[model samples]
Target: MKAHRLLTVAVLVAATACGISPTDVQDRGNAPTTRIPPPSKTIYLLKDGRLVLEPADVDNDTVGSLLGALFDASTKPLGERDTALRGFTYIGIKDSLNPIQRDEVQLPRTSTLTVYIRGEGTLTDLGKAQIVCTAQQDAAFEQVRIVRENEDRPSRTEGRYTCGELK
Candidate 1:
């Protein structure tokens, strides 16, 4: 019993001797923040003449991956909904000066994403809406500019558009 009391006293002294002091909680300002990723991938397709957001089974939410999925005929939702992306072929994401030569392209955290495409036919406003809305599904990309490149003519800007503007 004496030894137990002595050990308890020694523990108490050692704990108190440490530099740490009991104090009230400090107000250290706001906590750090983080961007939460979306629960599922989404792509824009046309329901009748209007744009509609549809859940996609795409592997990643990258601009290229989403565009690729948007263009893929097999993945198109059945019934009235159809893809306007068929009017143009998805080339790649336009970098600072040139298009990225890859199958998948991930945009920077927050920036405008420019996508290069070769229009198989005359790209209508609906086509532009499809491309713009589909690309903008990734929150990192605030706006999308569709650049149409033709073999016989110089590339032309279809106009920068946001999902809200098109849809």
Candidate 2:
């Protein structure tokens, strides 16, 4: 009887992970009795000539494993936690990169890259836009700045991060 119960639980976990809904599970107790949401927008990643492809946000529970989820383990798609934490991004690399040039794969000393974003979004009263930045970098670091708008004391903040290339 104990072995049977363990098997049942294992099967339940596997079914859920495979995108099966609780309602779809038969021979189970209460059909799981839980719900999770999938992601909205799809994204593509390219770094160091490597391509990384990622599906949309995916179920809220799995958000932590998504490319954007690398920013936060407990973050929802575009949800604001500004009063709590600063966010970062994960770069996408879909496929392996091959070398096909006269140069023998020599890396540069210093290269600056600028990404362009063209889309509509919501703004906070403090005037900061929430965006998913997916890029590759050698190390992770954040800068803080305090800006006073309207004679109010400037508040400390995490600097904007760019994640798309190796430094």
Candidate 3:
């Protein structure tokens, strides 16, 4: 009986030293009292005829990975159709018309990033517009120049563009 009383006093002393009351210890058995919101990142998407800013709860903030997700064909925006708006592709090789299927292409950290498109196809002008605007959103790329794979020079359709003009 004496040892039990001493143990209780020791526990009370330890709790007081830790700045936690015995009542607080008991209350801990209750459900969690605080909830922290998950971290999120802001990314742009094309909807209708404009780029829309949306917050996504992504794991990390790697620019390449974020670009990949933004370009992913399966990612659907809220209140939108299941299909992706930007289906444009490019062929980096000179004179080759092969289409690069992925949504994103990461260029070396440069002031101007050149995006080469397949010279001819059903690729719409809207897709090209989205590509230019989306790439320029990155801080590393201040200007985006779209060109054809086989063309030596940038055509009127293929030239330097800024996000401001498109978005």
Comparing candidate 1 with candidate 3, which one achieves the higher lDDT?
1
lDDT of 3 by residue, 1-167 (tens): 99999999999888789965454435547786885432225556556756666654456664344444545543444565222334444433122123334468644444666665544445445555555555555565666776655456544446767777665
In Å, residue 146's CA in model 2 sits off its true spot by 16
lDDT of model 2, residue 139: 21
Model 1 Cα lDDT, one tens digit per residue, 32-65 = 8997776347777788788888877688756788
- The best candidate by TM-score is 1
Instruction: Give TM per candidate.
Output: 0.64, 0.19, 0.43
Per-residue CA lDDT of candidate 2, range 80-166, in tens? Answer: 222111332333222222333446664533322222211222222222212223322212212111121222444323234343312
Error of 3 at 134 (Å): 2.2
Best candidate according to lDDT: 1
- The residue pairs that clash in candidate 2, if any, are 39-58, 51-93, 51-94, 52-93, 52-94, 91-135, 135-163, 135-164
Arranged by lDDT with the best first, the candidates are 1, 3, 2
Q: Tell how far residue 17 is off in model 1, in angstroms.
A: 13
Off by over 4 Å in 2: 1-28, 40-42, 46-61, 68-167
Which residue ranges in model 1 land beyond 4 Å of their true spot? 1-39, 74-77, 95-110
Cα-based lDDT for every prediction: 0.76, 0.33, 0.54
Candidate 3, overall lDDT? Answer: 0.54
